[model samples]
Every structure is written in structure tokens, then in C-alpha cells.
Target: MASNVNIEFRKLFINNEWVDSKSGKTFPVINPSTGESVADIQEADEADVNQAVQAAKKAFERKSTWTQMNASQRGELLIRLAHLIKDNVSIITELNTIDSGKPLTASIGEVLQGVSLLTYYAGLADKINGQTLLSDGPVFSYTRREPIGVCGLIVPWNFPISILCMKIGPALAAGCTLVIKPAEQTPLASLFIASLFKKAEFPAGVVNMVPGYGPTAGAAISNHMDIAKVSFTGSTEVGKLILKASADSNLKKVSLELGGKSPNIIFADADLDYAVEMAHQSIMYHSGQICCAGSRTYVHEDIYEEFVKRSVERAKKRVVGDGFDKKSESGPQVDEDSLKKILDLIESGKKEGAKLHCGGKRMDRSGYFVEPTVFSDVNENMRIGREEIFGPVQSIFKFKTIDEVIEKANNTHYGLAACVFTKDLETSLTVAHAIKAGTIWVNCVNYFSPQQPFGGYKQSGIGRELLVYNKILRLSLLYSLQIKTCKIILYCLTYSMKFCVYEMI
Candidate 1:
């Protein structure tokens, strides 16, 4: 176990300075594995949120250093941040493990993935460009790309640093300033990364981070009129509220990466052993807290019974303990509330007629640990089958035909990601094409890459993230249009006196 995992930063970061919340309130940050308070983070209220937005707005002004700086320079700073993250991977992994209740190895992988993403975005900073439009003689018109001013970024608790990088990388590369709000349950790693942002020498007010509950700090960011856009990763319920808040306030551009009830389909013709192992990793990793987790598993009826038996055996072998423990394959839920919710979902599944195969109880420990659970004979209408449990509870269903399974899989309201395991290329391609998810993995699970765009279908989300090249280009075009509109307005007003101006009678 990593013994040096401790809370380092507790203050809110604004204008490149560490400051306390204006409200003078604080909240305890707990380690889910030990049930111990790591530290008290300064809680930002509406007033502090206003301060952050103002700071970001200042930095995003045309004359400010952040907005006026060279694109290559901005990209260089991101590269520096990526290097710093690579250097401090151990500390980051430890902090995330303690705060997020993820196994040490998993935390390490997430940190490294974050590093890769940041580096990838850094390389694209100078490549944001626009094209010349076709025009007649004496008229030359072209498109120019630029930043979106100030952005409000809300990151979720699970995979804190990964999601943070996914949002901030593009915003920074596009020359936008930011006000970031990390989830209340896991804010330490984000604060640590903010320190690195300062170390990378990003201009003051270019990046700000506030830590607090959703109703206050999160709501404030969503409703702040000065924020040009908001990028959020969390529950679908909260995502909807953010949309409403944006409508009520500035009508800012919004991007949401919300909840999922992703399905994993296994065909009888496929390799059952490899499929079982991958499926186990899909749901049990991080105790199934991943937003794109394969919570629902559909196996061909021919191999459904054998799949369930093997899956239960594997679940029984999982080690549920502190995240810092090297031998621990899975850790606890993020907190007491999450533990309770997971337990409730498990019980509901039992009452809903899903047969409990194994592991439907909590571990005998102090932390918020739940057993690695598996249930069989689950139907689509069951509570566990329909909702995102967000824990180590796996529900298995039987399917006879591809047509029937495709309809059942697409029936969910969420469609962030899905996976299909089959040997035949035709079947794999058919299933992959038919699934309504934003991301589909054929014969694999939980696969992610920085170059590929990640988002959801329907209620899953609105836009994409980590879309390396195109995102920066799109943001640049939007920014150019905004600036041109302002210039046109100014030019028209300046020449208004030369034309016949009629006043309202």
C-alpha cells in the first residue's frame, strides 16, 4: 500500500492564486477505502463561482495574455503540463486511489492515459486553421478559427484526472480560459493537477478550479452568464439540470457526457473464456463505477448457463479491499451514499425476480466495500437491468437471436458505449453497426483512445470529447465568427452618421 497518499491542496484556485472560498465554508474529503477524512476542502458558493467566472472572463479578453498569446506557446505549456504529470505519476496515482476508491494499478493506468491525452491535444494547438471560401472577384472572404472565451468545466468523481484532461486539453488548446469544478467526493487529484498548471506557468486567470457541492458551486457555473460554454461529465439527471440552468441564464454552449446502461453481448460462436475475463474487467473494474461500464450482459442462450457459472467463480476470486493495496483487484464504492445505493439496487434486483447467482452482500470491513456480485436470469424490465448500478453488481441475460438482442440492447435510454464478443467478422460488423452507442468495441471492452471522439447517443450526451484535431478546428471557427460579428457591428455604427438615420417618431 502507498503510505504517502495525503491531501496537499485544500484552497480554491482562481487567477493562478490559491484562495479560500468567499463563503468561508469547508467540506470533508473522505477516503472511501478507509472511511477516514483526508482533509477539508474549501467549499465555493455562488459568490466564489462569480469570482471565478470574472477571472476567466478577464483572461479571455482580446487584450489579455491568454487570449493574445501565440498558439504555439499555448501548446508548449500543455506539453509542459503533460511532462510534469508524467514525472509525478506515482503521487497522482496514489492520490486518485485514496480519493476515488480505485485499485492502484487502475489509477496508474488512468493517470498515464491522461498524460497521453494532454500530450495529444498539445500537438494540435498550432494546427487549428480555416479555409478560404469561394468568392467572386473584388471580394475575398475566408474563415478563421479562435477560442470560445470562458468555459465552465464540471468533472465527475470517477477517473477524476482523466475527465479533467479530456475537458481542459481542448479548451486550453483552443485558447479558452476555464473555471473547473471537480466533483465533491474526489477533488484532491484535481487540486494537485491545478498546482501543476501553475508550475507550467499558464497565465494568471487562465485556469481556475473551485471545489464544492453541485447545488451551489455546480449550479453557479451552469447559470453564470459570463461563461461562454459548459462541459460536464456525470449523471444524466444532473446533466438535465445543467441544461435548464444554461437556458435560464446565458444560453451558453453545453456538452454533456452523462450516465450509461451499456450492454456487453457475447455470442455462442465466440471464445467463452476470453469473453468472461473481459466482461469481468468491464463491470468489476473500479467496482463498476465507470460511466461506460458494461452493466448489462447478454449471452447466447446456448452458453448463458456456462457463462454465468464461470463469471460467478471469477467474481468470488476478486479481492475487495483498500485501493492502495497492491493485491486488491477491486475497491469500495466512492462513499457511504454510493455504497447504500448499490446495496439498494442489488436488493431491488432480487425482488424484481433476478436470480442471485453469487455475491450480494457487503464485505466485512470498515470501508464502504461491497461484494463483487453477480446475478443471472435478469430481464430488461428489472431494476438492476434497467438502471446504472455503478457498483460491482453484474446482471446476466439470455439471448437466442441477434435480432432479438439488438432490440433489447437498444431499448435503454442511455447509450454511451457497448461491446460485442464474436469470432465471425460478419456478425461482429453487424452488431457493431446496429448498436446505438457512441462507442462500440468488437471483441473488446472498455477500449479508449485519445484520437477517437467519445460521447453518447440520445440521453447519453450531446457532444464529443478528446476529438483531437476537429474539436480545436470547430472551436476556432466559432470564435472567428464571434469576433467578426463584433467587428461588423462596430464598423456599421461608426458609419451610421453618413447614412440617413431615422429616429423613432
Candidate 2:
């Protein structure tokens, strides 16, 4: 994996060209698996953001090639981009693993998912259509959907490439250009994908990438007047800032996919073995760095003890090591800060009186590694059960009845996602409808697809992503028009103009 991986694209990508930051400043990209600096990436600042936004503005101009291209042609470009990504999956996977500390298999899966997403949007590009309304009078009225102009896409570190594609596919299919700000922790995969956009023959400035800290480049994107919309995926705190910035500036359309402390409910009648495994993966996969990870597990009191015992045993046996290793089930945290935060949260759980069943300390080995920790006998008030601990820490809480579990599940401000494990259909549907989350999974966890629309119901996020048709429609503007025939005009003038006025209204 090391031999195949290369950090070739590190500079800010503007107008289909690689260039140093205007500030000439650089930041080191650390390899979390080794706690070493892999490469120095050019840090994009406000000036670089302005340049990229200008490029996107130009590309989105009415007469520009990107705007003039037919919908089918845009779809072709996306298909080509998807192909290019599929062809270079290995290197991108390696880059993601090295940059974000995700296991190599998970990175590859995300890359493939990106391809599927692009392809889905590509198919929907030419199929977009507007509505024609029937008028009471001899007049024709219709609505046409047009591109919303240049968009600012802010990607998160947890799933950079996949989330970037989620924004890019629909924006391009809607004929909008983009200026992307990749997360500082993991910008390598995004910058590399920018090169693939060029290889796909996408017009210059159609896709631009600025790699820098959030306060600088990200703030510029949120506050930029030229950007028509801003789509962000990250923490809920940062999402609030972006919303405020948009309101303070041009009031651009903002869509956010934010943080979540999702609930995974296990009933007494559930297949205990399968439920345990799915619940474990829900919290443990990607070291619990996922935004919608099921960090809170609610178990029925009848099976609570057995579930806790099995979960602890599973955590004890789980592998936590370098991402490149095939046998490793989990990888290191993205950086030292994440590692420290997880450790601190684990300590808080202990202090708050949640029973730490197993694995509460950081690994003694190098790199930002932490043990797969499990805490049982957790309550709703406990920090471990309530907080969004974005780490390999699992918190299990005991519940009595269906109503009790449902109340416990909806206690958090977050309503991103939840899962219910049960063999009975009535119970599944009952819990699914009772839950306030945007997505409810029955007998499963962490299953995602391109066709599924994902977002949140409360403080978790603002808008939906994927579901190509709806997403692309949201990226467009609806323009309504009315036209009267000559016969109708003559009749109106000869008879009563009030009729025409009423019809128009």
C-alpha cells in the first residue's frame, strides 16, 4: 500500500490548475498511523478562496461553456469522471487511508460508493424536467428549473471523498459550478479527485478545491456574496456558524449534514447475536468517527446483561491497528486531538459513574490509536450516553418498555439516524414511526446507498442529500412564466380586461 500511494496533488486547485497559496503558507499532512508528517500541503487562505470563487463565478456565467453545455453533455462529463475515479480506486483508497486513518477496505468502499453516486446523478441529469400548469383562460403557464449558479461545498474529514461526491454530482448535474473547501485534516483525497475532474475534461473552473483551515477558507466560502448556495457536512457547531455567515452575507441557500449521537435499540426478542454484531459495528466502525454513528445503544432490561457481556467480549477481541493491515478491524484516530478527546471522554464516563466494562485507555503503541472501549450501565444523563463522542467508545443504556425506549431515543437534540433490531414487523414499524430521526433502519445499521435521501429532523442538519432527482431539483431555481395567445388577447380587449386580470392573478 505504501509503495502504491503518492501525494502528488497538494496545492490549491483553481481554474483547473495547481498553484501555491497566495500567502505561501503550508501545513503538514500527518500520517495518523505513524504520527508522522507525510507531506506539506499548501494552505489556502482568504485570497485563494476569492480566486477560486471568481473562477467558479466565471464558469457559471450564462454564456460560459459550462453553462451553455446541454444537460446530456453535463451527464457525460459526470459519467467520465465516475469512470476515472473507478479506474484509480486503489491509489485513492490508499491516499484516504493514509490521510484520514480509515481502514483500506472502508476507503475503497467509500470510493466505490462515490462512483455509484456520480453515476446515479449522471443518469438523472438529462431527465430533469419542470412542470406545465393548466390555466383557466386561454393562456399557457409553465415553470422551468435553472441552475442556481456557483456553489460553495464544505466537506468533512470523516468521509471526504464520498461526501464531496454527494455535493458535486447534483451541483454539476444542475449546471452549477463549485468552489470546494476540503477539511484540513483530510484534504488529500479531495485534491486528488480534482485532478480526475480535469482528466474527465470538465471545463476549467467547473470544480475548484481549496485546502486550508476552516476559519480562513471555510469562512470565506460561507461569506462570499458570489456563491449562490453553500452545502456543508461537519459538526453542528460549525453548521451554525455557516448558517449565520450565510444570513449575514447574501443569505445564500445553505444545506448542512451535521453531527449525530444516533440510537440503536435492541429488543428482548431480537436475534441477540446479530443485534450485538450490528450494534458493535455501528459504534466501532471507522473508530466511531462517523457523524451518524449509533453511539448510544438502548437495550431491553430482559436482555441487557447478556448484551453488555457480549459487547464487552467483542470489543476485547476487536483489532485496533494501522489501516493498511488487512486483519485490523479498526484504525487509529485521525490525529492527536481526536485521540485526546476520546481519552478525555472515556475518563468523563468513568467519573460520571458509567461502568467501563473493557478497554478505556489509549494503546501503548505509536500513532493515534485507542482501545475499543465499552461502557455499560449508562444513563441518559451520563456524558458518555448523551454527548457525541466521535471515537471508538460504546455506551449502553438499559430500558424497560417500547415507550420507555422511544422516549430515551428521542431525548437528544440530534435526530440524524436510528436503528431498531426486532423480528416483529409491527414493533419495527411502530418504533420507526415514533422515532423523530430522519432515517430509521430496521434490523440493520450504517447501510447507505446513492438512492437514499439522508439528512436530519432536528439540530442534526438542514437539508437532504443523495436521491439524485430531489437533490438536483433543490440545486435549481424555479422560474415561472405565463403567455397569452393572440386570440385570448383580442377576446380580452374586446370583452372584459377584468377577466384577463383575474386569470393572470
| Candidate 2 lDDT by residue in tens digits, 174-289 | 88899999989898888899999899999999999999999999999999999888899999999999999999999898888898999999999988888888789889988999
The per-residue C-alpha lDDT of model 2 at residue 396 equals 95
| Residue range 1-505, candidate 1, lDDT tens digits | 5457667799999999999998799999898888988889999999999998898888888888888888899999999999999999989988888889888878888888888888888888888877777777887777777676788999999889888998899989989889999999999989999999889999999999999999999999999989878899999999999999989998888888899999999999877888898788889988889998899999999999999999999999988888777788878899999999999999999999999988888888888999999999999899999998999999999999999999999999998988888878778778877888888877667766676688888899877777533333343322343311000000111212211101100
Return the TM-score for candidate 1, rounded to 2 decimals. 0.93
Where is model 1 more than 4 Å wrong at Cα? 468-505
Residue pairs that clash (backbone atoms under 3 angstroms), model 2: none
After superposition, candidate 2 runs with Cα above 4 Å error = 1-4, 467-505
Q: How many pairs in model 1 have backbone atoms within 3 A of each other, for residues 3 or more apart or on separate chains, i.e. clashes?
A: 2
Which TM-score value belongs to model 2? 0.93
